[model samples]
Target: MTSQFEYGSISSLQEIQRLGEIIQQCFGGSPNDWERYLNRIGAENFRVLRQGERAIAGLGIYHMGQWYGGKILSMAGIAAVGVPPEDRGKGIAYELLSRAIEELYQLGVPISVLYPATQALYRKVGYEQGGSFCRWELSVASIWLQERNLSIYPVSPINYTIFEDIYNQQAQVNNGNLVRHRAIWEQVLEPPKEEAIYAYLIGSENEPEGYIIFTQNREKQESAIEIRDWAILTASAAKRLWTFLGDHRSQIGKISWRGSPFDPFLLLLPEQTAKIIDRMNWMLRIIDVPSALSKRGYPMGLEAELHLEVRDDLLAANNGKFCLSVSEGRGEVTKGGKGTFQIDIRSLASLYTGFLTPQQLQLLDRLKATQEDLETARLLFSGSHPWMADFF
Candidate 1:
């Protein structure tokens, strides 16, 4: 027989360990493998559903920031949601979601986002559809390696500081870029294994121009190299960087890259058919609609106003409408009374990146606006693919 339990009371490390074991058993591994994950996301951020002495269901929360004019906090992210197989279809997961969302609301987290394994499941919980990421695969032979104007060298501890400086500059302008703290860099770049992350820095005139962090997988006797992070300041630099990767064409059979939906690599490869796979990585919501919208850079020569009615089932302040106006890289916000278009905050975030249009979101029922309002929203929110390179 199944039992009922309260949510959000999993406090101790022991309790978390017990819950982790349940996850491991159901999902096929020991939770100890996620120690780094647990540390990054503290146990206090998790909500657990316990029946008697046994923990059954749980969810994790993480924090992220959007670097605009000012920083927005309390951007909570949900992950590692699971319920035991025996307890499936009993509405346990749904109840846990409700309780977790309520707890996040109480904590004053303005936005809650998740990368749903199934998009339909989260929609029922009031999370809307966001834009997706594209994974591109290209054969090394297909890429024409340009003359190496710059020297490519392996990353070393000595040049870590210079590499970071160059990376930070690229990350700032790159929308959908994750702000990698020092801890994240240490964990990703210097893990404790032979399969540790490999990094390469491109130097021009003794100065760094680009860098890439990647790892090799040798499973199935086939060599597959996955690029974890890649950034170059110029197109020529990008070509030179890929040319370096092409040098390993004989040994490395396949190369995969993940980035914005408008990645230029797709345009570079004309001879071979590059496979593009669309997968949603990050889901963003406007914690402060006016501030979040106004902070992000928009396409030039576009001036318009949008009335956003963001329904924050968790946070009350974000549940109302606000008028947003932008022109010449400046924006203003007013009370959304007497507005032209109405959209939810989640929809607004999806539109923020220009990967998905207001009309497209409207068709998906993610945005609710009239025809004229939809046209206005489409005009203001449209831009090149907006994507964050990292999933924080």
Candidate 2:
């Protein structure tokens, strides 16, 4: 942290382009694509660590929300993080990410998520591998289908609202799914590039229970259908959607999902055809500890409280003890009394997302807790394994 090193948004087009060039140099993407992304998200969402007029490192901040423990939590997503090839190993990237976390904490965001190219860099800033992007691949012929009366219709532009409603219902019940904001919806529906994207809805027209968003592609006469997003609420709707996908076997060879580990569609496909083609680890950081814990939904039937001695290096405000209590599906976090368990920020991040169990952390020597505390911690942290479908 030098006096000359400033962290903030780019002020001019020249700076933005220069920053884009540096980002391109590090990220290996075309400048035009970066420009398009900046245009879509807006210039102000990006921040730079600069030495006076020179932008040495940059990161894009997204004001987003994720579902955790069956409820939506405010999340600041970090994207397009980069430093010039010349500036590597100078601590520029660390300062930029640290400042981004600090700013998000000050803005009252509870948690932060990012797709890390490497785990070590993020781990130093209290981030841990939190969730998984489990993409299931299946041959088109293998989708199980039973003949049903449910109708599947292509979603018109007028029916986007129905698609959104169905998604909200599905996301609310799943952990670590994004609560797609209005802007996000608008961004998703933007005109396609190269290949056309399709959206199909099942059930009644006015109130769709299930919908699938995907794209069709072919290379060297081998075609495949890629499922970009989807949600189904009922058995019949799921049958309809899988039957709909099953209908594609004649034209497409394979299907890939942008889904989590707990996808129901996997159950509808033949076990032989269904394979996990890719699993990407996404990292999370608990920026504001109390708020992150209190705001996320917990199981309603459980009752427990723990005195947590947390260690946060980047955010001084979070470096202390706190009492966390959960009851009736809500949490109450207050200042310290007598600390029961001692944990550092990275381990806490893992605990906060239910990515790792307290007992497991204690066994790994990342958490120190008594038997009673471990049992209570397990009950407190039990829920759907945290996973994010969207990568920003």
Best by lDDT: 2
**What TM-score goes with each of the models?**
0.81, 0.95
Which candidate number has the best TM-score? 2
lDDT of 1 at 166: 78
- Which whole-number lDDT from 0 to 100 does residue 26 have in model 1? 59
Clashes of 2: 1
lDDT for residue 15 in candidate 1, whole number 0-100: 79
Tens-place lDDT per residue, model 2, 16-49, is 9988898888778797778777876679888999
lDDT of each: 0.66, 0.82
Q: Which residue pairs does candidate 2 place in steric collision?
A: 67-176
